[model samples]
Target: MKRTRVALALAPFVLLTGCGGLSGGPPSAAPGTNAPPTVPRTATVTVTVSPSTPSASASPGSPGESKLGPPTSTREVTVRRTTDNPPLVLGVRFAKHDGFDRVVIDLSGGRPGYSAHWVPKLVQDGSGDPIDAPGGAYLQVTVTPANAHGETGSPTWVGGPVFHAGLGNVRSVVKTGDFEAVVGVGIVLDHRAAFRILEQRDPQRLVVDVAH
Candidate 1:
């Protein structure tokens, strides 16, 4: 009876040791044995992309925007600005584009009035002499209330009288005249085609694009 009572007293201490350590952490690895490391569990995320469409307001071909086909005329293109201290013509330049030929006229002082149309022939202002510009058809771009000089009478046009564009449609461009308050730029093309005009600001310039 005395031995049985002693055994019962030590039973609680033996139960605690059989369970894990008191701190409740993972058990230590066996001595001198290779143990594997514990790696954290993670989730993999995936993302999908979608294509964007053109906006409703963006059309196929518009002024200043290029496209695959020829230009379409929006009625008769004309801008008339009458001023006494008119815009001065700086220079004339041209280049060949994807579906058209471009001609640019640089200007300053102010925005000037302009008239572009198919003319039978181009004539020199004041002198009335006929111009023998290259190409078969003539498209005359006339800027009114404009000058090729400033108040000091210094010529603003550095390279003029004529320029050979040599594009798909346009053959050349010529400064037919700079008389009175008007300045003329004649576009010589292989034949008449649909053309468009654009008026740009900031520095103020006139652009003409002929369909190829």
Candidate 2:
């Protein structure tokens, strides 16, 4: 009976030692010490692109944007009848500007009626003779009630049928005819382009401007 009581006392001591060993024996660090270092995660990013806007000077019909202007007037333009206001052709001058070439016709008496058009080939006034105007394109300018002569039948405009203009766009100027109260002036261009005509008075001038 004494041996059985001693065995029961030792059994409780053995059970306590086994429970301590199962709890990792002893702690390597204190409780609530330095926590595990937090690892940072990389974030994803997104980007977007948009088209740029045009400036205020960006016009559709600007000279820098287009190489050529609008088409010139195709139909005939006449100021007055051929019999009215006979004017004498005094001189012819040529000028070169930024993007155009100009031809100025000086008159003595008054402004005369004229017809200007693009022609496939420029011919003489009276005789059906072909004028060898030096250019890739030709403009036939005819002024009515006008003459390149004075009252005594002297040649006022002292130039030939073919005159070398050598301007920006105008290659040459040809006097196709001056017959029967009509004066003909041919403009030869380096290339086909748009042109405009203007009439100025006081000294009575006819102006032709061709785009380069």
Candidate 3:
């Protein structure tokens, strides 16, 4: 009877093995049980920045108006001859600054008396030949008691009768003459405008500023 009972108990297990119900594997959750906890996913994001560009029609002192100055007028100016002090012409130079164009005449020995005036046309000092000054207006600059040649008759300032300045306002400088202990410089302007003359010491220089 014990062997008969043992066979009956082993019968259900043998039947479960035939049906593949006891395969060795991990246990699954019950129908109503919560699923295994899932790890949260993370995402990354990036951002970019761009620079701003300036536009046209922007007002002065604005971003787009950088590196530029306001326009100025060109009025007539003159400096009369005071004393006859002979100065030797050393060199000439030009510069563009602020609201004007500057022409500098370097001198040595002594500062000479000068006369600066606007003229309808530029003419040679002794020759009276019409100077081909390339500008709408002309400034006649005369330096007295000055010479382009030294006492030994050697040239101090020797160059062409016409010098191309090509500055802001002054276009050309014409060497009119070095006659009668006087030196003449003709300034050609792009347009007829206001101008001023200044004399500075310490090495002595004649400065001509024309409005741009």
Candidate 4:
């Protein structure tokens, strides 16, 4: 009876004492006091510039001029048909704009000698004038935040072609194709540009300028 009583008293002590060394060895060093909350990382962007070239000399389409001022009003652009067989253009998408806007084309199937030049009045200016870029084999898009389909601000041209600070919204120009080529202008101001050519299965995507 005495032994049983002694065991009962020591049993609690032993169990409590062993908790620290039981299933595992001695407890690990108290985890370094909780670390301070971590901070999120942010991306840093860089800007580079190149010499300015004659806006008219590149190709030809819209008149070369500054349309940076505020828009007097708003207007929509009309869809035009191309001569390519099987209709190379599947769909044309444009970004939302307050001053100048952009139209993007989704190709159904790429053609060798695909080229883009401004035709007739697709849209109008803020003053309600018919917009035209009639020149050369290529179409010259008069890039201004307010004039280009109600899009606001200038384009940041980047990548190998060139970036001219004098031209506010203009960013980069890219040409793609082995036998035949097409020129593309990257209007995305937030991204930087990169280009790559793939063989066989992978689709060859020519990124004019990506957001930085």
lDDT of 2 by residue, 1-212 (tens): 45554434432111110111112222235467876433221111121212232112212333321233323422323334333347789878887866878788888765466767678888999897998886899988887778998778898888788989898789998888889898999999998776655555565677676767
User: TM-score for every candidate vs. truth?
Assistant: 0.65, 0.62, 0.61, 0.18
In Å, residue 12's CA in model 1 sits off its true spot by 99
The parts of candidate 3 lying over 4 Å away from their true place are 1-85
Q: Decide which is better by lDDT, 1 or 2.
A: 1
The residue ranges of model 2 lying beyond 4 angstroms of the native Cα positions read 1-76, 82-84
**Residue 86, candidate 4: C-alpha displacement in angstroms:** 3.4
Model 3 lDDT at residue 126: 81
For each candidate in the order shown, give its overall lDDT on alpha carbons.
Answer: 0.65, 0.64, 0.61, 0.22
**TM-score of model 4 relative to the true fold?**
0.18
Error of 3 at 156 (Å): 1.1
- Candidate 2 structure lDDT: 0.64
Quick one: best lDDT, which candidate? Answer: 1
* lDDT for each residue of candidate 3 in 79-171, tens digit (9 for 90 to 100): 333333467898677777777677788888554556666788999888888987768888787777688898888878788689898877788
Ranking by lDDT: 1, 2, 3, 4
